[model samples]
Target: MPPPALTRLSVDELVGMAGVNPWELHDRLMVGRPEQIDELANSFHRAASRVAEGDGVFGEARSCFQGAYSAQSGGDTINASPEVTKTANDFQLGASQLDTISRSLDEVAHALTTAQKTTGEYVGSLNAALSQLDAMAEAIGPGSGANEQQYNQIRAEGAGVVGSAGDLVTGVVTSYQSTLQDHMALAQANRWHSGSARRGGDPAATIPGNGTDPATVKQWWEGLSATDKQRLIDEHPDRIGNLNGVPIADRSAANELSVDRDIHRVDDVAAAHHVPSDEVLAHPELYGLDASAVTRYRNANHVLDARKTDANGGRNRTYVMAYDPLAFGGKGRAAVTIGDPDQADNIAVVVPGTGNHVNKGWSGAKDSISLYEQANKADPDHKTAVVSWMGYDAPDSPTDPRMLTPATARASGAALADDVNSLWATHDGSPQHVTVIGHSYGSTTVADAAAANQMHATDVALIGCPGTDLAHNAGDFHLDGGHVYVGDASTDPVGMLSSSPLGMPGISVAGVDGPGLGDADPAGVNYGAQRFKAEASDASPGSFVTFADHSQYYKPGSESLYNLSTIAAGHGDSLGDQGMLAVHRPSVAPVSVPNPLGGILGPDRINLPNPLDTGIGKLADPELLRGGVTDNHNH
Candidate 1:
């Protein structure tokens, strides 16, 4: 694998061969360890490859280290380390920290390798000179006209070759010995020198924080030992799953591992009790007897299904952000990311609304894949991460009283805010843009969260919105008016009834304030939002086309999907300034509703055009009519 070992020679002979009196301690050593140096170099290269690819956190840092070695190593100078630490959020701190040590060795290796190459070239030049002199001596025969000149040249060149070779050999020996010692000393000082101790850290008690602060959580994650990480996943998967700021890759790994453990746990229990799992699957509350265990098994299967393999047989990674069956009094909350958010250049989080449940998969994995593919098509160069974030107990049937108010949105808003904030916190600068897209009632959730928490996002999109409460205009969101986009279609009766125009039926029925009681509808012209085409056509500006209905905005071929992808790719500016599907701004201006309760202000207006005569009332249930908008219209 390497060049044949250099022939060994005694120290005195080596000194005499070099003819250098300046050399001191080198004259005393009898043995050489050139092979040890070669072996150590191999080890360094092998470790570098693993550290570079094993975890996403370390990969960026590794690249920076290699870049430094290449650019400055040749000059025999070391500058300050750039903040490559930003890339590696999971660099464990302790005696076993190897990232810095590895980098240090890399720098030394560059210097040593350069020195060795230069000395070898010197030795080669000497050998070449001696060969040339021997050839000239043979050609000349004896003393001729130019024979004397040739002989002098030959003697001088031969002597020079001998002297140069000896000096080069001495230099190689001295340099290699010192470099080897430096490398060995540094490795020994770091506990990570040995493979066994490389993964060491403190116990679980030392785990920092409650896993909220992204920076702090990353630090804590890095400080943990190998055993600690595994134990956290096994013991507190819910905490691990919902913990924001942890890398999605790690979360996916932890979740999958927990899923496996959960399956085994259920199987072990079922086997011990002679419980028929077939019967358990059929009716968990009845035949299974242990409803809690059945819930665990079901959640485990949900994760297993999510672990489906791609065409290339690679497991599609899924981050289980939140998974708790007993959350919000049994309604539960779940969030999953279809791709790695930390490494992507663009990230979009989709929140689903009405009739969402774990059984129905609030935001199904299939749905996530479709969105992911759409984003890829939108911007092929930048890696896009799409999140199916159903991190709340969403409202069920429209008949439910809770659906009429903003209570569900208010409670879930806090959780949604935390989820989005975590992304910004853990992100290592790749994703320059982040967008939050909410559909149907989910739109309302996004609005409520953004308004309450001042959510950090580059863009906020509301699709098929059903009254985003209290948002009188797009500017009411955390982002500016230009950053909020809305898509709604006229054929969608849900969109029509819910859009809070002057004296709108849906708004009045909520028992809030005016007809436009809840929030200004994005399609109502006055909401000050950008709404472009959504009807799956390549028509010009004046061409007529039907917009998609409430449930069809996300369909593959729909115009809404195209527009959404465009916006997600940060091309919203291309559409210019035009609200989609709204031919004219609301003709009748909104009149502020009375706020007799002092600071309880809202955009409640009177003397407005009632939407009842427009037949929007016929589509609504009687309960909606009974709530207060039946016949109270001023014609």
Candidate 2:
């Protein structure tokens, strides 16, 4: 038989699209499109390096110019060379702009590399989960009968894995959209340099709600054009969001943009380090941070990034009402909401005690999320939200002398009051219940906030408090006695520290002359505030989990957590006397003359014992707060 004759293409077929050269097309198809992307990234990388080098050159020249000018010893004109100085200043500004562009390009390139790797990992996980599902199906033997219960259980678990993979994809899309929005905001800010954004005067002019009503700020904001509003966000997000009169929705939105912008800003400021290929081409999650880059990166942006995710991989919406990472010389202040408060039926704003701020924002979020989730469970039909308000520069460590006094609380209380009111300002129609919950020194903050202005809160809860500064009883808080709740663990120490006369300088000095801890212990039956039972099941890091220690307040499944959530959810049961606590009241200090040691060794130093373990000073906490009589020893 003759070799199979090859079918010859007709001239008409050859003229058609199929007649294109197969070999050349295959080569181009395989490599062309992807190469375009790679080339763009590589080119950007090269440009960034060259621009960075140019900045260093300009910086050196500026330094030399400064030195040469300084060395000249003559009159004004000779000593300061205006022409030279201007040239150097111009160079510095040019270098800065170049550096910014270079950094932005690097970020774009890293994002591309990271996306590719993530896709690969996700595809692998999807395949694995699918394989497990198949295995479980096969295990049932199809036609043969098996233990129905066991088969269902296996199938359920497999299905969960598949669902989780789907959730992962959804999360990726959400994160990308969020990141894109952040980048857009930053871009707008980069282009905005006009001085017109401050038409409302300085944000600090009236201190949000101190003297001016938030409604006024809202009115002023509403009158402005959309362009002006955008200008404010681009130029003064920190001011606009933290301002009391601003609408809640606008503030939350502005602050959200600011949070992401701050994170990227941190990256720009700390971009001096070289992100070598090892990290540049690594995980997008790392954002091209090397070992050294990682440290700088975290130091600069961890506080902002930490708020993005929850304990689980799931994303929870956190509103950044106010955030200043470098406030008070880098001590930091931030207020993060667990869910939307304006929309929630019940809202609780939690003030963390001393030794906590932006750095511990995530840990604070974990606690607030617990309260948030629990509140949801308690009131399944209504929305309940929590805000981890570390908006104050809390007294640093317990060892610091400042923590013992309410100086920080006194300084920060008015802001807290304004913030609480701001929540209501943004709410339309009638009103929603507002609860201000303070933990440890934070209780003092809450009390001070209320006493300074009308807090508008329906309830005030103090957990593990030292003392309320001045209000002798719950009646002094302006809120009804039944609405004030105090939760003091049986083992908590500083809990009662503020309740004693010694906790306050006025009390310890001359029969309550200075800021003493407890004007009157709210936990005492005489104080007339609801005292909920608090038993330690999970103490702090260094202490044992005995009923005699601290730190079980927000522990999962703990009784205190249950009661706290109950009140936060506006639960009727929380008001019932289920955990009504009764404890021995500590004796008041005898009025005495002032002494130096009295300042350091509070009344408790004189052997107050368990009796001093009073719950948070609920009503007069602000009075005690004004006294700066706070003991966040275990907060």
Off by over 4 Å in 1: 1-202, 208-211, 267-276, 281-289, 306-316, 480-482, 499-517, 535-548, 576-635
User: Which residue window of length 10 is worst by lDDT in model 2?
Assistant: 1-10
What TM-score would each prediction reach against the true structure?
Answer: 0.56, 0.55
Q: Count backbone clashes in candidate 2.
A: 28
Tens digits of per-residue lDDT, candidate 1, 332-368, equal 5566676678777888888887777665555445556
- Quick one: best TM-score, which candidate? 1
Instruction: Give candidate 2's error at residue 477 in angstroms.
Output: 1.0
Candidate 2: tens digits of C-alpha lDDT, residues 1-635: 11111122121222142232222222222332434544654664465466557657866876665567667843344325644443433333333333443444344344334333433343344444444445555566534355566655655554444344333333333333333343344333333222233323543221222223456556556655687687777777777776666766677777767666755543553454455433432433455334433333332354455455554454766677676666443556667777778788888898888777665443565688778777778788878878888776676666544454444565467568768887887766454777788888788778777765457688888887777764567776786323788887645766656534343322322233443334455665667677765555443323322423455678767667777888888763444665334343444333334433332223323323232223223322221212211122110
Worst 10 residues of 1 by lDDT: 626-635
| RMSD to the hidden true structure, all candidates | 33.9, 25.6
